[model samples]
Target chain A: MISIDKYAYNSRLRRRDPMQKLVFAMMTLSVCIWAEKIIISIAVIFIMGGMTVLKGGTPFPFFLRLLLVPMIFLLVGVFTIAVNICENQEMLLWAIPFAGKWIGFSDASLVKSLKLFLRALGAVSCLYFLSLNTPMVDLLAAFRRLGMPKVFVELMELVYRFIFSLMETADTIYNAQNCRLGYSSLCSSYRSLAIMASMLFIKSYKQSKALYTALEARGYEGEINVLEEAYESHWGWYIMAVAVNALLVLFVIALKSITGGLS
Target chain B: MNENILETKDLHYIYADGAVALKGISIGIKKGKCTAVLGANGAGKSTMFLNFNGIYRPSSGQVLFNGKPIDYSRKGLKELRRKIGMVFQDPDNQLFSASVFQDISFGVVNMKLPEKECRRRVDNAMEQIGITHLRDKPTHSLSFGQKKRVAIAGVLAMEPEVLVLDEPTAGLDPIGVSELMKMLRQIQTTLGITVVISTHDIDIVPLYCDYVFVMYHGMMVLEGTPKQVFTQKETIRDINLRLPRIGHLMEILKYKDDFDLDDSINTISEARIALKDWKARYLKR
Candidate 1:
């Protein structure tokens, strides 16, 4: 999580308007899911990956590693969908006989699983493109501009600010415990973790109260009203986003017309 | 009008759980002057500060701003908070937003100022704290010293008449402490904003603060210039505080080492000048 945040801040696209990125990522994600075609999914993945690495200056290896994060879950889910019992033994492409049944992946199941896997990956890549290029603060600001609930955005802002402090505190506590041999044994490790967790909860509670007091001192009368930072944005980025998504849609339409549907 | 920008009269604060934090404390913070509230842990300096901004209503006393009692009404409190910005010690607690620029603009925006004016104040405050480079950085990405500056910038943008900082130098390094104090002194002098900081850093008191108030067990035990306050050595030590290191050294030189140096010299430069004069006098022998 920290690495992603760090990369986002350091990315060349960090100063770009977050709304444009949000629109582009969401549009591509929906297109990837809606097209339901393996080729389109692959195209969407490449488009987002190129945008993140080439334009945003995120390292290609790092982007590839981030893409692989969801692969394990996708493979497990796709495996369940691919392997199934069939009444007709001849329907199974590669099957084993099991108590008067055939259990294996058929050609249709394999295609469906492959499409689902790519679609999931493609959607994930779209989000990664957005997150890799835009800091959470910028994203939250974009959400506020999009008319997200005021309280929701404020809560996110506070949580985002305190997350680092909480992490630092947790690190300090863990180090203190380690120095005292609190984690010498597995049993003691569990004990120490529980104690730390409870301590963290209490500490955060007190911190919240203190934060409230601090906010009040600044004249926070119920709402966390802050000035929205102005970004050096132009309509050109939105236009480009729309034009790219239009091309994707046209490509999907042309493919559907040419192939006469997903099959 | 009175010279004091803020004053607390017989202020007492009792927590809901029956713990007394401040007991009838009264002190006047002079307008446009830097003041230090020296205290040990649990000295109720923070509680008293909250009372100044009307965050915690005193149990049985009045907090006067500019010789007029603070208005506790919602609208009045808002106006008062706008003029008396309070920067908490922990930047994390004070900076509620991840964005440095936005966090700095928070207090100013609450004042319902025009958009352009708000932007100007935020930019000016960032420049004042020497954090224009950090304006685009997230609060979490900043170092502790940078975050401290950002926190101060956040309050400074409000253009408050009196800036109250609770333990401003608490978690800073030695250089950070001096740098921050110097920056604050610059702000106080240039902006003419009355500044009050609560700290146990004895050395900085004489070097930076024009006047000092010593708090012990929620009561005001001493109030004077740094020189006058540090002269009450016995009382200061009884409250678990101490003279500045230079003052201690000068005391030893004058008494233990039989040097004819001034014992009241608390700051480094003062001790240096005093030792130079003593050497000049002793050269005749």
Candidate 2:
């Protein structure tokens, strides 16, 4: 997760407007989910993957690792959809009998599960394209511009800002405890961890008060107002995004007609 | 005649938990000069700073900005904050944004400046601090010194007339400490901004500050130029603070070593000059 955040800040495409990236990602995701054709799903995956890797300059190995993060959940969900309960052996690819009932994989169920799995993966790839290329600051800025609730964005901004500080504090305290032999035994480790947690709470509470004072010292008037991020506002990126999603739509339509609207 | 830009008159502050943080403290900060507030930990340096910018109202006294008592009204506070930017000791607390650009621009943006002007100020401040390269870096990714610079840039972007930094050199390395003070001194002279800092780093106080205020137990024990303050070695030592290392060494050389040299030198350059004069004048004896 941290590496993904690092890459998002370092990506070559980071300089592009986040709203544009968000739009392309959301549009492609919606199309991938809406159009249930397997070919279009596969095409969406390739498009998002290629954009993230080739244009954003994110390494392929990193992107592949991120994709694998969702794979376990996806496979578990798809397993339920692919399994079937049957009385007869008809169309049973593999059957396991239990308590006078047969559970097996059927061809139709398998095809349906494959389509569902690909569709979900395709949609997830679109989001990956956005997260891998846009830093959280830019995304929050875009959300602010898009009229996200002021309180929500402010909370997210502060939370995101402090997460790193809190983590670093925890790491330091943990190391300090370890050095003092406070964690030599499992019981001692638990006791030390509990003490650290309480200490972290007090520190964070004090930090929040201090943060408020600092913000107030700077003329903060109940707002986390910051400068709107500058980005390369290019018409070509929007046009290209629309063109790609439109092509995917056309492909879905053509596939449906060829298959006689089987889906 | 109004040389003092910020002044505290019999200022007192008590934390809610029945602790007297400042006890009838009074001091003045000159306009367009670098002032150092030297104190040990928990000696109310931070509380005094809070009073400077109206972050905390004094319990029984007054904080004056430019010969006027600070106005605590919303509009008045906003106007005051526009003129006096306070940079906290911890950059993490002061910097509420991960992006250096956004964090630096936060202060200026609060004043409702136009987008272009905010960008210009951010760019200019980054250039002043020589952290233009860290513009796109995340706040967490920056080193301690870089983060400190970014924090300073955040306040500088607002173009405040008085910059109050709490322990600006606390977490910095030796090189970073000198470089940061140099940068701040340059900024102060070049921009004519009043720089006020609170620190326990006694060495740099003599080197960089024009005037020093020594705080002990929430009371202003002494106030003067660096030479005037550090020369009172016993008085300084009474408050859990001490003279700068060079100043102490000069004192011992004069008293213990029986060197017939002035013990008032607080910097290496002054020591060199004083020693050379002594040698030229007394070597024949």
Candidate 3:
């Protein structure tokens, strides 16, 4: 998460208009979910990966690592869908006898799980592409432009910024405790961790109070009305995004016609 | 009309927890001048600053801007804040936005300026603070000194009549301290903004501040130019503060070293000038 945030700030595509990025990511994601074809999913993955690693300048290995993060959950989830308990086992690829019946992988279930897993991964990659290029500030700004409620955007902005501060505070508290031998024993470790958590809560409360006063002093007047910074807007990026998504849709249609429906 | 831009007339604030942070703080901040409020820890410096722009309503007296008592209404507070911007000590607290550009634009945007005007001011503020290179950087990635500059820029973009910074150089390296103070001095004079800062960094007080107000126990212990304030060494020491390092050196040279030098020299340049004069006179004698 931290790496993603750092990359977002330094991303080569960071200057791109956030709304354009948001539109591109969300549109591709929805299409990827709707298409439900392994080929289309593969295409989405490659598109998002290429955008993030090549254009966005994120390290390819990092992108792959992030893509692998959800595979564990996807594998387990798809495993259940791929395996089934059945009385008739003619289509079973692998079977185990259990409870006077058979539990095994069937051809249809295996194909279904494969498509499901790939589709989910493709959707996640689309999100990664967006997050890897757009900083939280810009994303929140995009959301604000999208007519998300002011309070919600404000909360998100504050939460996003303070998460770093809270983590730093927690780290400092942990180090201070370590120097004092507060974590010498298991019992003491639990006590120290608990104390640190509570101290962080108190500290955060104080910080929020201070932030409120500071904001109020700056004519906050209850709304965090910050100017949206101008980004490099290009009609070419919009055209490319539409053309690419259109091709993905056409490919999905061709696959549906050729395979008589990938689902 | 009074020449003072900001005045707290016997202002008092007691927190809900029943702790009286200020008994009475009455001080007039001169316009277009750098005023340093000198105080030790928990000496009500922060509390008094909160009162400066009506962030904390005084329980007893009044806060005056340009000799007029502040209106605490919502609309009135908004106007007051536009004229009197306050920058806190902790950059982390002051910088609520992740992006430096967005954070700097907050004040200007809140003032309901045109979008183009807001952008211009934000860009100008970043340029003034020499953080235009950091315009795209996240707040978390900035170093302590950079964050401090961003916080000041956040207030300066508003183009306030008076900029109140609490401990503007609390946790800075020596060079960072000098650079930040110098930039603030430039901002004050160049933009014609009245700058008020509360700090324990006494050495810079003599070099930077035109007027000084010493706060002890929530009340003004002394108020004068830096030369006059630092010369009252015993009263400063009573308040758990001290003279500037150069002033202390000059004091030693006058009393302990039995050298004939001015008692009011608090900065290095003045000490140098005084020492050269002393040397010429002593050698001739």
RMSD of each: 1.6, 1.6, 2.0
C-alpha lDDT score of every prediction, in listed order: 0.92, 0.92, 0.91
Q: What DockQ would you assign to candidate 2? A: 0.81
Model 2: lDDT equals: 0.92
TM-score of chain B of each: 0.99, 0.98, 0.98
DockQ of 3: 0.83
Q: What share of the true interface contacts does each candidate keep?
A: 0.88, 0.88, 0.95
Give lDDT tens digits, candidate 1, residues A159-255: 8888898899999999999999999999999999999999999999999998889888888889988887777699998898888889888988998
TM-score of each: 0.97, 0.97, 0.95
Candidate 2 local lDDT, A1-263, one digit each (tens): 78989999989999999999999999999999999878888999999999999999999998999989899999999999999999887768999997798899999999999999999999999999999999999999889989999999999988998999999999999999999999999999999999999999999999999898888888888888887767998899899989998988898888789888897
Judged by whole-model lDDT over C-alpha atoms, candidate 3 comes out at 0.91
Better of 2 and 3 by TM-score: 2
Runs in model 2 lying further than 4 Å from the true structure: B282-285
Per-residue lDDT tens digits for candidate 1, residues B1-285, read 689999989999999999999999889999999999999999999999999999999999889999999989999999999999999988887888888898898888888899999999999999999999997788888888898899999999999999999999989999999999999999999999999999998999999999999999999999999999988989999999988999999988889999988888999899889988888898978
Candidate 3: segments with Cα more than 4 A from true spot: A86-90, A96-103
Q: How close is candidate 1 to the true structure, as a TM-score?
A: 0.97
Each candidate's DockQ: 0.82, 0.81, 0.83
